[model samples]
Target: MKTITKYIKISALALVATFGSCSKILEEQPRSIYEPGFFETERGIMGGLTSMYAHLRWIYGQAYWYNTLLTGTDEVTYAQQADQNFLVMDLSGRALMNAENSRADAIWGICFSNINTANGIIEFAQQVDGVTEAHIGEARFFRAFDYFLLAQTFGGVPLDLGAGELTFNTSTTRSSVRNTVPEVYTKAIFPDLLHAAEHLPETGRVVGGVTKTLARLYLAKAYLTYGWWLENPNNIPTYPAADRIDPDGHDAQWYFQQAYNVAVQGIENPGPFRLQQTYYDVNLATNDRNNELLLYADHTETSEFYNGGSLTWGNGGAPDNFAGWMLTWNYTEIRSSSSSSAWSAVSSVQREAAQALGRPWVRMAPTIGALSNTFADKTNDSRYDGTFTTVYRGNWNKAGIQGPLYNANYLPVNPGDAILTFLNEEPTQAISYGAPFNSNVGAGVLPGRADFVISPSGVSRRIYPGLWKLGPYRTDSGSGLGEPNAGSTRPFTAAKFSELYLVAAEAAVKGASTRAGFTARDLVNVIRARAGVWRWDNNGNTERIEDNSAAMIASTPAEITIEYILAERSREYFGEGYRWHDLVRTQKWTQLASSYTICGPNIGDRTPIVFQRNIENFHYLRPIPLGQLDAMEGDRGIYQNPGYD
Candidate 1:
């Protein structure tokens, strides 16, 4: 990422107040007055860090920004036609988003602002005797983390080392040239992380704070991303590269090995982190502070609400709340305000699923092929069943409020409705009509299009399977009033330790020079074992995906390849935010996307949608926001990325 952005939105002096700026550190300044030297004290240090985290949380939690990352991958895709920016991103054609793009600009601003704040903390904290190493370490970790994200998003950014701390004049006169991808990683990212690892404690801190293991995790990720960027098969490196940024030119193999080493260190380290016992527990809001999370963009039920509805009516623009993750809801979930009076020739199981789920904002939908491939082992592979909303134990308080409920499985007259659905299946031995009691029926068959029906009210509802993870069904005081809407309380899982298995396995299969003291197969099998997949040979502890090629099981680790690792990654972190980057870093965007042949039932008349998409090598990085260039007076040394208009 660029080290110094010529144009600065957040002034540096406002970050960590410098010492000696105040007449004396002895005087207690008013609560409102923020001047230099205040940050030298423990209170100022904590306040500065707290403010920085609050700002970071707001930046990372935007629905628009999150959508950009979630959809348009092998695991997920945008479904709504009206969300043009989402479509453009998911379909992969635009070099630059339209001039008024909010998500892109917000991310750019937030990342750079945090970067500047970190720099101030580091500079000021190092000068103070009372300030501890932990403070500086946290600052370094955030700096590295922000830069790493910027590099992944925008290729390269300015290298600013707190040069303008005394002067608040950031946007006017300060000029900074761009750094190369390798330079960002080697000089800034690597060094900051090393410092962070050195100072960050081994255990126990706030949920959002970094640990030694977390720092190591970021290092592994950095090495992998840097390695991939250096040896990108489709795109040539833009040089002359920075000094010692692999001046000797190592191949991707070496980088993968390095990544393996770092990942293994984090994996084997005696830390508080561990995978949750169940896949669903990994993301349950109640499990927000679980051991599986190394670090996450923290949100709470009261404070950091998802607040998606608030965005549309001008209540908030690109708000901080992280709600309405459309990735979890499939196309079938219809808005409650719309038609709900009729069920036309639909199974009772389908009705139960519909009733049980939260509000369906089907902006993004999973392709049928991706779903079939991902959940092929529906009976086992606890992940597939565990993560999705297959059944609904009716809470009559919520269901009864819907009023005049239809399904016989709904015993609202008694305790409540406890029913479930099998989207595509038609199991034997069931009542041909009313409510399905023991709905074990699997997908009966596929219509050439998606499996859905036009309700008797003539409303088109696409009924592919929906994930239960996205439902933040909080209140049921009234029907259709309390559902997952804009500004509603819904939590998004920003990061988790479960992905370590995937990352470690990717490095291992890519032929890490040395073993991680465990084989790639072993790493993957460990995850599978936790999931308790019934299809796998439990006694032998070997996975048994029917379609896994015979050649892949051969003698060497290379046979375990990137493909197997990706499939496993999708199964494990399906709706989580890893899909797009995973595809891009491995140079498999087009290859993986090209595999989509089968499609789901469409709500609209749009015909014959195929899975194959238009992803190009140039799409490896998103275009720098047009505003940034315009801010540089059109010629502040930074240039637009290649292939973007």
Candidate 2:
């Protein structure tokens, strides 16, 4: 049974004051209106459980920060300038330092707050009468989920299982990095998920319990990450040596097989979700039955509250458009030009002139440049259509122009150029050119010009070529709901089912094959078929079949598995937040950081850059905030992880 918890009406000042005092102060303050005593009844238990779900708002809202920080910059690049914060991080090459304080604080506080609430629920739910085993199972599932996130980011965090037996003490020493990787998995995460699976109903099922399918999903992820860490401990720096339990213990493959088993169980369950026939078919605008592969999702449509819809466009703000909607300067255009004789002449002149002036046009690496060529191919590949919007000629009613116009460079005047024109009241000439042109040009007819010559076709003629699918069309004046420019309203694009197929494929290769489940090749084939690619034998390997089948078929599964996972992730989830973490987890940071280059105004050729992972200071996790450290006392060594000064 679903229940709702109305938010408590406490003033912001009161909340600040209450938490500001030490644990002793907390005791003196008036107790919360709704305490453990109030939640001893069935209705109260239900309300408490529902409040746990409320915490999900914070999690999903915080996703933008994670997605942007992870994807933008050398770690990842925005296709356009709509969301420039992440792009600026890449451009500036700064560490994940205290400079971005609010986001850091939000992440830290929200996770802990959720954990605290879950603790209260878990502790009190046990004492409530008429509360079935299912309530206990839900509380455990949420507790484990919260811990899973904490474990992922801040390794070996203090495990607070319940409200303290003693009074809340602000000066307590933090627990030692207690659980080993396997130990944490076995002790905290796995037990809760297993219990949840036992209590949850079968597929086509929803109750007060987390369904069996959801438990299997969580377990599958745990097993996969565990296997990856055991095999490649060097990649995950946050928990060094945690993966190495013993020199001669069970191999990485064993853990992977376990993950595979759980994934198979989830796949075999008769869930309502499945992959959409095409990538374009998944939309919030359509009232479709959510999909077969969605293990769990917040069904509430609070897009406004959490700003999920705003992410459809670039980062949300004025003066800057959304990141996903802006077009980037196509390096392919520059590369192709560099290779041509005519372009060679122009480039040679530009190069010599720049060299004389101690500047040069930035050039991307040959390998990175190949991505554009690959994407530009107008094939029946599903990704091309799914990922990029097509360019076409159209009138810009605002500008009173009729021709193709690239969205990236859509401003009326080049902000950097130093020229201006003014209207003149002469019959033959409508406007006159002016000198000392430091001001912006106003819209008017130019003298001796018949009409504006808009380019029919060129790189500059397209807007946000690859990242333009954030939402549907809207007027410039922000009138309609779900329109691109509507005030405080935006379109929606949820990442859905097709990704599960990729997950299943990767899981299958790593040991997830069960009798009832699809093989890696089978999963890939199904996805490729949706992309309009015809299937061939290709030796029954997903990676090989998808990535130039002839060449990859000869490679071993281990070699093929990594390659397939990376390529599939890049093609399927490029603009999303997965790439940076993917690179970090696989230990490819140093290579990619050193190899890639950026091009834009103010950034020239030979300008070296490095991602946070490449630097030594970033090896250990980022420091807990200074304020948090100050609140604790004695044995700082126990509180902090290794590698800090």
Choose the strongest candidate by TM-score: 1
In order, the Cα lDDT scores of the candidates are: 0.55, 0.40
Candidate 1 per-residue lDDT, tens place, 1-645, comes to: 222343234333223323343222111121332334655666676555654554444554465676666666776666543266566666544223543452555577666766765665676776776667877888888888888988887777667433442122233343445677777777789889988877898773454567888887887888787777766666643422343347447777787887888777778883888987666566554455688877654443432222322421223234434334454334233211112333322222222222235445555666665666665655445666545654333344333343323333322221233233343233332323212321122121112211212211111113444565544534332442243443434434556676666677788877776564467887777677666523333112245543222222332244567887888788887766677778877888877874443234343322335555676666667777766666554453336666565
Best by lDDT: 1
- Assess the local accuracy of residue 160 in candidate 1 as a C-alpha lDDT between 0 and 100: 49
Error of 2 at 276 (Å): 1.0
Deviating ranges (above 4 Å) for candidate 1: 1-38, 92-102, 161-171, 236-245, 248-251, 303-319, 328-356, 391-404, 408-463, 473-483, 486-491, 533-558, 594-608, 636-638
Q: Which stretches of candidate 2 lie over 4 Å from their true place?
A: 1-34, 61-64, 72-75, 78-105, 161-180, 202-210, 233-243, 246-251, 283-289, 292-378, 389-500, 511-517, 533-559, 591-594, 601-627, 635-645
Q: lDDT of model 1 at residue 242? A: 42
Q: Write the per-residue lDDT of candidate 2 for residues 274-372, one digit (tens) a residue.
A: 666554444322323345334222322234332323423334332122323223223212111112112221111111100001111111111132134
